[model samples]
Target: MMKQISLMITSVALTFAMNICAQQSPWDKADAIVQSLDPVTFPDKTYVITDFGAVGDGKTLCKEAFEKAITICSDNGGGKITVPAGTYYMNGPLVFKSNVNVHLEKGAILDFSTNESDYLPAVITRWEGTELFNYSPLIYAYHVQNIALTGEGTVNGNGSKKFSPWNNIQTVEQEMLRKMGRTNVPVYRRIFGEGYKLRPGFIEPFGCANVRIEGVTIMDSPFWVIHPIFCNNVIVRNVTVDSHNYNNDGCDPESCRNVLIEGCTFSTGDDAIAIKSGRDNDAWRIGQPTENVVIRNCSFRSKINGVCIGSEIAGGVRNIFIENITIPKSSNAIYFKSNLDRGAYIQDVYVRNVQADTVRTALIRFEPNYKGERSAFHPTLFDSFLIENVTCKQSNECGIYMAGFAERPLQNIVLKNVTIGKVPTPYCFQNGENIRFQSVKVNGKKLDEKPTPKELVKLRVL
Candidate 1:
């Protein structure tokens, strides 16, 4: 009898251990993804821009010198193009070649010219999710592999003086572009440069692999600051962005896979980090989803969202993990927005360990009717979100807000250990199923039950 009891106890212990091992933390996959990434490294050869007849007087145009140096470095099989201290004026874009690392030493600045003519001779680029021939991005790369932009230096776009004013006039052209996208127009014919006012991104690497942008200070971006489109195995680390111009989102990773963004600081006019795929028919044609992204240890003080997932997510997005975020001030702490015209699935997102103060809107929000633009009948499926261990000091609006389409409601969302200190309203939810809250507190009151119909606020389109 004693032997049988001991055997039973051992069996129970073994079963418990097996169950624990089976229920691994979701971050284990994140760790494996990080381990799978390959760090970008260049050859030991260093080509100094000064030696190539580039003047750093902040007045002379060094476009030719840059072109010459980059070409030579690239021809020599791969190396570092080093820029020493001083301000270097660039009249044109810095078009990158494969296997080149642009390293800027401390106190160095690459000041881009504001003249639109400097960016003439349009390049094949994507503008706001639609493929077009447009002015080249300030730092542009296409189909390059193993590229990097690193150093403790500043890249000044000088955009507020020139491109910020164009935002007021871009509405008509913007609508035209969206219409073209909705109509499935061929990407080759969508040309808008020279006379068009659509602003270009600051740093864009399109269709590249194994890219890195680290330790750089970006400022005065006309549009999105650091945008990587259709890229794979990219890393953006230890970067600082302080651009407050219109549409100057700090970083946007669009249609990318296996991306890692960490140790970044942002003070932006828009979202600190916005993940996007493509838009409308253009997205459907491409059929690429943004997936396997990890963002952590970031600080934000934004005029808009702290971390956002699209108003341009027509292509699907999945398997995103975000943690250890601090938001001193923002319009919203966490936001997810999509519209009826965007037909895709955004699922399997995990967020934790976030702290925010002075949120102007809700701490967390899900809006399926974003912008109220219904050019098509396709509706996005918003599902499978797990948000936990989030705390907010105060919110000007409600604590949590959700609005989903009746046809395709938000599904399988779980919030655990979330607390909001002060808010006028606690929650506003509509058309969401399998939405659960555990240990959730708002306005110092525990939300133990589903909100009543009378408590649901009308949808206020942002």
Candidate 2:
């Protein structure tokens, strides 16, 4: 009888905690969205690439074999194209068809050539939110539904010498694209390829639906490692990404909906996962918000932010949930960044059950003043952000740092059940309203007016 009573008490406590979490936002709708997302399904057929005269010795270019396999599979009502073990050197991008799955067996490596000329005859894609005909991503799928890339094999970008060197020459191209983005230049006219210094992403699915990328080891990406733009019902599960180039973000879901990124490990030079919409005028024109995104059970070791909301959030971001995440070595665990040029609303974001170990800079950071070119659409709204049940082993800076514009201050930001071991600086807040902290601890004590870490260091020296 006592054991039954104890179980009942435990259930009641869990119910109470869930209810408290639900009270702050529309969790039921979010849960519904999550539950409805089904895994991508393929027809019952498989095409082996080696049968199509593909060699896997890592030197012979098998672009024709891959293309033929995809064609055969698509022609036969769409099925999986199997890539068996051994390194298959692809000289160009491989496009996916509807209801197709590219399955790689263990020990199979799909390595793309380093020559920029190989990825010519540019395909329609988005570069930093602007639609254009640019160099194709290493693996690209456009307007395809019910497609997946599933396997234990590696999709190697081979970007160390060839693509990584383009970063130095990208300044001119970057400024040109930004200018085109601001001026609402026609996307067709903004062609960049071949001679252009813009590097292509590793895996990107544009304007697609019902996509899944599972269990693939992505490494040495030229740009954003795995990017899905304007996609719906996307699932990226159990993928491993390790890239340390200029903009080697692990995964970026841009202008997408119903995205689930779970059980992924990331060690990258940029954000582990960045949610973006379009950029500036282009994003405003596309007008699609990146909503219904859930990032859970993930580990991140990044040089920059762990999970970022936006700096290219011109189409707004909403209804996001992040839970059960571990940031072992990142500058910030939860980072929301937007600037004056990004005229979008970032609201209804919740982060919970997060563990931060040696977060090099800050645990929770919100910078509404993320640097960008000024625009008339300035005052973006950031509201209803909640962080709960977070524990940090150490932080070099404050536990929480929020800065908002005076005209459009951040609203209803809540922090609950958070503990930080060594946040030597006070929680900083500016231009905010209704910011609440419940059971928040720093250095095993509740936060109060404390000397900065620098001040403490000076006193110790004295």
Candidate 3:
């Protein structure tokens, strides 16, 4: 009887240990970490920003007040810097430091002045993947750690003003006239060359660690929104990112590591979530790939591709797992685009248990448009792509497409357990090696083909 009891206990212990060793997704850890931190103990409360002569400005540019507040918060062991209940306007970028919290009170608005001079040039930044010294982002953080932006308040870029004020036009086209250099603008534009050149955009946080942006609203970004470059251990949860204007993407996590983006809402004019490893020369300089990304329970609504990778995958991306996503509206539910300029391999990407409604194009696409997207700046490559257990309802077009360039094939991909509703056929595979499927069904029926890949490429592209 004693031996029997011991054996039972030993069996349970072994099972528990194995469960612990298994790879757990980011959502499992996100909620607990958020609850552990006490909001009252934020850095802004302890340091106090008044010493910097910063005041809550309603109309005028309160650059001094914000700088003082940020400086004080930085000096005093880093605390939450308060943007009091009012409109605080700034002409230039405000840099954030380590161990600090930038919390906006209810009804508070941090308005970034759109004057070109206000955003000083020569800031270390990346645009579309290329590295360059460009205009400052509304809220900038570089080389920081343990940072967070939490509140019910808003951060407005005032980008609309730039189009009307600088260029005297209505939208991105007029703003193009106001753009500093006509020649320079194309340097940052998408699908230009091998995707190596710098195209200026908004908000780049480089080499950061343990970052979080929660319960905040970011609107009217001047360019690609919320770009975290070469960061690690990042979390952006419970946030609302909305922009109806041009080129305002919700977030682009490029060359980052250990990232978790969950419980966030994204609605933008462009790709809601654009993943890239690096662009052009930076891809080679920063050879490290984006690793360990887990995006769960995040919903997106975008005019462009909902959740996309490449068009700027110069460095290579891997180990990306996007699950439990609900994209109600988009041109395409999930898109994987690559060309000759992007030489990096995209591998270990798992998109499962996702549902898309009212999709215009194929739900999941891997296309290397040979003559369509050739760039001199950013080099490109496509490899080891996978889509599984995805159900697209009321798709107006085809369901899945894996068509590649004649030179470089889209190889080692698998589509399993996919069900498409209200479509003729589920897939249209053009070129690739080791593409397989298992238990694949469309419109409640099994398919004639099987999807079997060579091996799972364990990599990271956040």
Best by TM-score: 1
Instruction: Select the stronger candidate by lDDT from 2 and 3.
Output: 2
130-231: candidate 2 lDDT, tens digit per residue: 777889889999898888999999999988879988889899998898888889889888899977989998899999999999999999999989999999
Clashing pairs in 1: none
Candidates 1 and 3, the one with greater lDDT: 1
Q: Predict model 2's lDDT versus the native.
A: 0.86
User: Per-residue lDDT tens digits of candidate 1, residues 1-462?
Assistant: 999999999999999999998898888878887888888899899999999988889998988888898889888898999999999999999988988999999999999999998998888877788888888899999998989999999999998999888889999999898888878888788888899999988999999999999999999998999999999999999999999999889988999999999999999998898999988888988989999999999998899899999878888999999999999999889999988888898899999999999898889988887878786678899999999999999998878998887789889998899999999988888888888888899988899755433245543444
- Model 1 segments beyond 4 Å from truth? 1-22, 449-462
| Candidate 3 lDDT by residue in tens digits, 149-248 | 8889888887765622332233453233224222344434423212122223556678887788888888877777788988887778888888766666
> Per TM-score, what order, best first?
1, 2, 3
Error of 1 at 103 (Å): 0.6
- For model 2, the superposed segments whose C-alpha errors exceed 4 Å read 1-26, 375-377, 448-462
Instruction: For candidate 1, give the lDDT of residue 252.
Output: 89
Worst 10 residues of 2 by lDDT: 453-462
Candidate 3: C-alpha lDDT: 0.69
